[model samples]
Structures are given as structure tokens and as C-alpha cells.
Target: MAKNTVQFQQGFSLQEFISQYGSEGQCHQALFQWRWPDGFKCPKCGHVRYCSLKSRKLLQCNRRRSQISVTAGTIFDSTKLPLTTWFLAIYLVTQSKVSVSALSMKRTLGVSYNTALLMKHKIQQVIKERDDSKPIASYIIQLDGAYWGGKKRDGRRGRGTTGKLPFVAAVSTDDQGHPIEMRFSQVRAFSKDAIIEWATQHLCIGDEVVSDGLNCFNGLDEAGFDHRVIITGGGPESVKMAEFKWVNTIIGNVKRSLHGTFHAISKKHFSRYLAGFCYRFNRRFDLRQLLPRFSFVDLRTPPIPQRILKVAELCG
Candidate 1:
């Protein structure tokens, strides 16, 4: 009801995206404006005045005569692809419930699989970095540790399965129980020290953290968070309890969406995929703003080379 209000509803349409970012010039204009809201300035000399080269689309600092391309220092660095192509990639990434895989990107964007994979990784890294720069703080955060991946032939089961990844899912709600913010993060494990480290990074002082009774979560309080552990004892009925209704629902949705969409994702790449899910969910209420906001974030992110992306950690 309240979420259906104009302020919280999604208003951005495909037509709107096309009109705003249809051409290379249009996307470049938006990037130029976002990259330098006050006008072009040399990163080297910090000069406000500059001259633009129409032939090469480069800018020169008036004071030091330093030259800078529109994407020199930003995420688009060294990119030979057109701005429209990048903008379309950003749009597809942001405007989906599940993620746009490399295969999907190749089909949709008309690129090779390798090129699509590179583009997807680059954009995913941008979203991950952007979310990492901000902290989530709310009155109430419903948290739970979850595992992903199929069973192993080693006969290990459940959370202890050999190939699974341990991720912490948290959804913050208002006093009335309406969901507000969410943070889904992949952790090294669900140990006490891990939870403590997570709390220190993602939460603020006095924020209440709600969780099913797990001993590992006990460390959150020691890290200065106001922790509340609700012991449901392990049972199917208890799992259906209203105390963690939204948290449970979100976890189910995340699992289903990921499993249903991708054929199979590598273990190390789980963090990036999870980051994409969180990025879309966290911005769900800001439907119309997702594309432009994500574009701006991409502009702020440093260009992530393939080798660097391969070694980057999503959680750390």
C-alpha cells in the first residue's frame, strides 16, 4: 500500500532510457556532466577552465595545458566501445530482477561471449564497489546466514557442503515491519569473528540486529551493535514464524532467482553475483533512478581490468 506510492514506485521505462541515453553523444553528455558537474577540470592541475577538442573529444586544462579525455580517469578508461553500448550494458544490469549473464548479454547486446563476459564483469565490479563505499544502518536489521551451491559427492550435506559459500543476508525494516534497506554479503565463514567484522563494517552504533539464535551472531553485540537473537530452535514451523518473515522471504527469493537464472556460476564469483542481487533489491524502490544512478556509479568506479577483476574479492 504505502510502497505503491509514487515516491516509492518504479517509474523508469525502456522508452525513457532510450530517449535519455540513446546515442553515443547523449550518453557522453550525461557522463561529462556527471564526471565534472562544475565543468571540465584537469585531474593533474585541478584547473576549472578548459578547451574541448571537437575532433578528438578531448579537453585541455587552461592553466597547465594538460589534456584529458572524457573518460580518462573514470571506469570507462581505455574503452574502445561506444558510450551507448556501455550505457545499454548498464541498463540491462540494473533493470533486471535476476542478473544478466554473459551469455544473455552476448545475445542481447550482440557481442561475443568473451566480450560479454568482460563487460558483465566490469559492470558488476562497478556496482560492487559502489555498494561497498556506503554503509547500511537502520532501526531494525533481520539477519541470517545462508549457504549456496549444490550437494557434493563427498557426502557432505547442508551448510557443510564442500562447494558452498557462506553469505549473510540482512533486511532492515521500520517499526511497522515494512522493509526499508537490505544488505547481502558473502563472508569467509559464519564464525564469531566474521560476524563481528561484518557488524563493524556494515552497521552503525545503536542499530538493532535481529537474527535467529546462532552463537556466531553473539559477537555482534561485542562490536557495538544492539543485537537481538530470537531462538526458534531448529524446526520447520519455527522457520515459518512471523518474527523473521521478511528475512526468510528475501532469502528464498534470492536463492530461487539465482538458481533459476544462471546455468552455473563459479564459487569465487558468487560474491559478484550476490552483489548484483543486492544492488537491484536495494534500489527497487527507486525504479526510475536506478539506471542514471548506476551510470553515475560506473563513472565513479575506476576501470577494472580483466586480470584485476579475476582476483578481486567481493566480500573483502
Candidate 2:
């Protein structure tokens, strides 16, 4: 009957965001501090002394004379949009409980649909890169597999169904079974080999992994995890099982959130979209810090151009 503190907590307000990063100058200053907290240092030579090239908005190294723009090499590189637009985009993406579609972003940011989509993907790339680097290491972990995409008219359904994308969803819980950290990985298939590979990279050795009795999950034990199998056979009842409660709930939320927000998700970019949800979920404890934290990571993330974003396949 008690209120959930996390749900009720004060988040970063639009007024506050505007006060902090209302102008291009404010965004540039914040980016500068995030990129170089100590002071200006040449990226090429690591020299401490630098002079500003106000004429072109670049910083020149005193020793090497090499010039670099504050946005160079970051996710903002070569962007024709103002830093204010980028900052507002970050605010909308990070602060939204569910995800924001590019169409909505286009209307809000007043940019072309393609440009909005590019910005969304580029920001999601930063989030995906940041979250993908932090693997889950916990004592009690709930694991489950879920599929994305619409249902087909064909008789095919469930695992191995045509047009469905298989992904592994996991949530690390506390002793009382409160979900903490989470992970969502898009795998080629939910086969034994695929499960093993994903477990090796995202899960830690000796962690307790509780999952449904899917044969492919047998790979968890082989991969050095203390695997606990719960055979809650199909239908709605399986999702109600206590042992897999958190994982199932998270998977449900992800499916509903993504399906409700975006009209379509490309096969090549599914991982990044999944990563965006995981990133926000893992950091949900502090809504107030989400924007600044995301901004920091965005500044450090390498540039992802339209060409790279258009790649046919992902490394996943």
C-alpha cells in the first residue's frame, strides 16, 4: 500500500533544464567541462595550454598549433544543428519514461524527419555503447528470452517464428527480490551456442541465474554460472511464476514500451534500441541526474555518421 519512492521522486524539470542549458553557449560550456573537466587539453598532444580560435570556434594547441572543435570526434561532430537543439533532444530522450519516436522528435525539435531519426540513432548509439560496456554482476539474477516484431498470419509462432527477433532479457535483484540492474541483448537466435556466447559476455561467473526451462539456457551452467532452472510451462501462468517475476515483468514492459512508441524498428538497429531502454532502466534510480550523466557519456562517445548508422548489419 506504500508509495514507490522511485516513482514519486522529483525528476529534472523542463524549467530547470532550460535554465541550465537554454542557449548554445550554455551547451557548449557544459560540453567543454564534460569533455575536459580539468581544463582545455589538446587531444593530439595532451598539452595544457590552448588558445581559442573565436573566428572558427576551435581551440588551438599552444605547443602543436593543432586546432580542434569542442564537438569534434564526439557524437555532435559535423552536426549542422545548434547545440541547443541537440541538448533538447537529449532532454526529451533521456527524461521520457517510455521512448520517443523520431516522428515526435521531428515535430518537437522542428527538424526534418530524417534529421530527427539520425539524431535519435546517434544518441541511442552513445547510450548503447555506454551500457554495453557495463556487464551485470549480481548474486540473484532472473533471466528470460523474449521476441519482438508483430505477429504473422502464418501458423508459425513462438520461438523460431518467422519475423520475430529473439533477445535475452535479464534483471539482477536484491535479496528481497527487488530488481536492480538489467540487460537486453539481441541475439541471432535463442540457440544453445547463442545463449552461451551472450552469457559469457554479459553475465559474470558464479552468479546465480534463474531462468525458465528452455534447453538453450543449459548453456548458462556450462558457462560457469550457478544456473537454476524453473520449468513453469507455457501460457499466461508461466509469466506469473514468482521465480521469474522480475525478468518477465521487464520483458513485458520493454515490449509494450517499444511497440507503443516506435512505428517500426529495423533489424540492423534493434540492439541500439534495446540498449536505450536498458540504459534508462539501469539508471532509473536517479531521474534528476539522467540528463547530465547522458550528456557526459555523449560527449565521450565517438562520432557515428549517417553512413555508419546506415550499415546493413550490427556487430550483435
Candidate 3:
């Protein structure tokens, strides 16, 4: 009967984004502030005083005379794009609920597909790195194993499907059983060793983990966490069970978002996409602050080289 606060909330709009980071100079100033919150400290010498050379957009450290731009060493390093454009890209990526694809980003930003893909991957790399550093430690955790990719026609099915990727979906909830954060991690397989390794890295000890009756989940017990299994047997009835309600709902939402946003996803680069989704979902509580917070993290994240960015690696 009551209004849903998160659904009805006022989110950050393009108008507000323009008002704040509308110009190149505005974006530069914002990046400077976000990068050096305690005032300008030289990255090389740690000098507190610096002279801003507005003509060339560099700062000279008073101590060592070392020069640096606010964008230097950060994800925006050596980028030819205007800071305003970069900020807009960040805004679009953070503000969307279903996530943005590189092709859609190309159309929106009026850039080539390759350039847009580069920008998207760079931003997602920063997000993936940031989220990977923080592990889920919520009191009540719900976890489920899932697979991505369409069915193969070779008669192979379910977990053994040739083209499918195995992944674990975990939702951390509050005392009232509402999801507060989530982690989507790709795994080698649903074997005991794999589950133990993933759980050891992603989940904290002493937290209770709720899951269905999958034998692989016994690894959670071996990992020394409090594990509770609800045997919701397969089919529609199982998915409808209350014990797995939020986890099932989240998984469904994830599938929908993937189907609606992306046409196809490569297996190697899939982890970053999952990490990007988790990053957005975990930070969904404050839509207004999402841009600034994401930008702040972006400024702190080191620039990932194009060579490194092109390679696929595992990330949660």
C-alpha cells in the first residue's frame, strides 16, 4: 500500500549532471578536488603546495617542481577525450539500472564503437577493481549457483552444457531479510574445490550462508562458515519457495538485465560485466551520489593499459 522509497526516489538527472560537470573546466576542477581531497599533494614528492598552470593544465609541486595533471596516473590518464565527455560517460554508466552496452554508448556519445568500447571497459575496470577489494560480510547471506549462455543443440544440457559459464550469485541481507549487497562471481565449475576457493575469497568467516541443497555447497561448511541448506527441489515450486525468494528474484533480475541490455557476451570478459552489475547493485541505495562516488573511485583507480584491459581475468 505504501510507496517504495527506492523506486520513487529522485535520482540524479542529466540536468543536474550538466549543472555540476557541464564544462571541461568544471570537470577538471571536480577531478582535482576528488583526487586530492586534502588539498593538492604532489604525487611524486608529497608536497602540499603547488602552482596550477592553467595554460597547459599541469600542476608544479613547490618542493620538487614535479609536474602532474589531476588526470595523470588515474583511469583518465593520457585520454584525448575532454574531461566533460569522460564525466558524461561515467554518469551514463552509473545512472542506468539495466547497464549500458558499448554499442548503445557509441550512439549516445556519438563516438566510434571501438572508442566507446574502450571507454566502457576502462570504466568497468575501475569498478571491478574497487569492488574486488571489498568482500561480502553481511549477517544473513543467500547464495545460489547459476549459469549463463544459451543452450547448445548438441543434446548436452544443464551444468554440462558446452557453451555455458558457471557462476555463483550471492546476496547479503539485513536482519529483516532484505538484500543489502550482492556479489556475482564466475567459477571454474561447481565442484567442491571451486566453491571452497570462491567462498574463502568472497565471504567472511562467522557469517551464516543460506543456500539450496546442492552438494557442492558443502564446501561452505569446510570453509568454516555457518551454512544452512534448504532443500528446495527443482522446478517451479522450488523457485517459489520463500527460503530462496530474494536470491531467486535477484537471479531473475540479473538474467533480464543481461538479455535486455547486451546482445551477446564473451566468456572471457564476462566476469567484469558481472562485477559491474554487482558494483551498481551494491551502490543502488544512493542514486544521487552514485556519479560522484563512482568518479571519486575512478580518480583513485590507476590507469589500466589498453593491453591489460584487452585481456580477460577473473573478478567478482
Give the alpha carbon lDDT tens digit for every residue of 188-277 in model 1.
888999988887888887888888878899898778778888998866676687768887899888888887778677776787888898
Model 2's TM-score against the true structure: 0.93
Tens digits of per-residue lDDT for model 3, 1-316: 9998887789988999999999989998988888888888887877799898889899999888888988887778888888887888888888888788888888888887777777888888888888878788597899999888756577633444655899999999888888889999999988899999999888899989999888999999988989999987777888877767887898889888888888778777788788888888888878998877887888777678778666233221
lDDT tens digits by residue: candidate 2, 1-316: 9989888889889999999999988998888898899998888998999888877878899998999899988878887899999999988888888888888998999998777888888888899888777678576999988788755567544554666789999999988888888899899888899999999888888789999898899999888889999888788888888888888888889888986887677888888889888888888889988987987887777777667686333221
Candidate 1 vs candidate 2: which has greater lDDT? 2
RMSD of each: 3.2, 2.6, 2.6
Once fitted onto the true fold, the runs of candidate 3 whose alpha carbons sit more than 4 angstroms away are 152-160, 311-316
Could you tell me which residue pairs clash in candidate 3?
none
Where's the lowest-lDDT run of ten residues in candidate 2? 307-316
- Cα lDDT, all candidates: 0.79, 0.85, 0.84
C-alpha root-mean-square deviation, candidate 2: 2.6
Q: Please provide TM-scores, in order, for all candidate models, with all chains considered together.
A: 0.90, 0.93, 0.94
Assess candidate 3 and give its TM-score to the true structure. 0.94
Sorting all predicted structures by lDDT, with the top scorer first, yields 2, 3, 1
